[model samples]
Target: MFQKVEYSGTKAQQYETLLFQVKALTDGEPNLIANLANASSLLNQFLNDINWVGFYLKDGDKDELVLGPFHGLPACVRIPFHKGVCGKAANTKTTQRIANVHEFPGHIACDAASNSEIVIPLISNGELIGVLDIDSPKFERFDDEDQHFLEKLVNILENTIN
Candidate 1:
C-alpha cells in the first residue's frame, strides 16, 4: 500500500524518500516508459505548487524533444532543440530555471497558467537523453534549493535509466 505523508518533511528527508520510491519502482525493471512515469510521479510528490512534472525525450536524429511521461495539462508534443525552455536546456546541456516565463527567450507557453519553470537535462554516460521539466503557476516559485534538490534527484536516475 502507498502511504502518504505531509509535505512538512525536511528537504533531505523528502528527497531520500523520493529516491527510495524511485528505487522501489525501477528495481530490476528495464522499461523506459515505466521509469519515466515513476520519475514524473516522484517529482510531483516532492515539489510544491507544480503545475507540470515530466520529461521531454530527445529525438537524436531530429534534434528535438518530444513530450514523454507528464503529470499535468496537455503539453507541446514536439519541440525543436532550439526552442522553448526544454529545448534550451537540451541544447546547452544545462539546467534552466526561470522565475518568469515571459522573460525566457523563446518560451513556449503550452499552458498559459504556467509562470515559472525548471528543466534539468537527463544525461547518461555523458550523453544527453532527455530533460526533467517542472512548471509552476506562481512567480519565483522555485529557488536554489529546488535546483539543488532536483539535481540530486536526477543523479539518482542516472544509474537507473542510463
Candidate 2:
C-alpha cells in the first residue's frame, strides 16, 4: 500500500523523502514494469506543476524510444533516438532539462500544454534502459534542484528495476 507524501521543508528535503518513499514502494519487487508503474505514480503524486510523467524505453535493437508507463494525457508513441528531448537524453545518456520546449529545436510536442521538460537517462550495467521524462505547463518550472532530485529518483529506479 502507498501513502501520500506530506512534503515539508526545503525542496531538497522533500525530494529526499520522495526517494525514500520510492525505495519503500519498489523494494523487493523484481518486476520492472511494476516498479516503473509505481514509480511514475509516486512521482505524479509528489511533483507539482507537472502535466506529464513517464518512461520511454529503448526498444531492443532499435534506434527509437517506445512509450512505457506514464501519468498524463496520451503521448507520442514513438520517438526516434535523434529527434526530441527524450531522444537526446537517450542518445547522450544524460539529463536534459529544458525551460521552454518551444525554444528547443526539433522538440517533439507530444503535448502542446507542456512548456518545460526534464528527461533523465536510465542506465544499468553499462546498458541503456530508457529515460524518465517529466513535463510541466509553466515555463522554467524545473530548476537545478528538480534535476538533482529527479536524477536521484532515476538512480533508485535503475538500481531496483533490474
Candidate 3:
C-alpha cells in the first residue's frame, strides 16, 4: 500500500525520503512504462517551481529518443542526438542542468513558459536507455543538490528497468 508522505527536513533529507519511496514503488515492478509512469508522478508531486517532469526512452531502431511518461504539458515526441537539452544528455550520456533555456544553443521549446531545464541520461549496463527531463518556469531552478538527488532517483528507475 502506498501512502502520501509529508517530508520535513533539509532538502537533502527530503530527497533521501524520495529515494526510499522510489525503491518501494519500483522494487517489484518489471514493466518499464509502468515504473516510469509512477516515477514521473512521484517527481511531479514532490518538486516545486517545475512545469514538467518526464522520461524519454531511446528508440530501439535508431539514434533518437521517444517520449515516455510525463506529468505536464505535451512535449516534443522525438529528439535526435545532440539537438536539445534532452538530446545532449542522451547523446553525451551526461546530465545537463541549464540555468536558462533561452541561453542554450539549439534549444527546443515545447513550452514557452519554461525557463530552465535539466536532463539526466539513464544508462543501464553501459547502454543508453533514455533520459529524465524536468523543466521549470523559474531560472536556475535546478542546482547541484537537485542534480545529485535526481540522479539517485534515476538510479532507482534504471535498476528496475534494466
What CA root-mean-square deviation does each model show from the true structure? 1.5, 1.0, 1.2
Q: Candidate 2 regions off by >4 Å? A: none
TM-score for all predictions? 0.92, 0.96, 0.96
Each candidate's clash count: 0, 0, 0
- Tens digit of per-residue lDDT, candidate 1, span 74-104: 9999999999999999999999999999999
lDDT of 3: 0.93
lDDT for each residue of candidate 2 in 35-147, tens digit (9 for 90 to 100): 89988998999999999999999999898999999999999999999999999999999899999999999999989999999999999998889999999999999999899
Q: What is the lDDT of candidate 2?
A: 0.92
Which residue pairs does candidate 3 place in steric collision?
Answer: none
Give a tens-digit lDDT track for model 3, residues 27-97. Answer: 98999999999999989988999999999999996889999999999889999986999999998999999
In model 3, what lDDT does residue 139 have?
Answer: 100
Best by lDDT: 3
The whole-model lDDT of each prediction reads: 0.87, 0.92, 0.93
Judge candidate 3 at residue 137 and give its lDDT. 100
Taking all chains together, the TM-score of candidate 1 against the true structure is: 0.92
Clashes of 2: 0
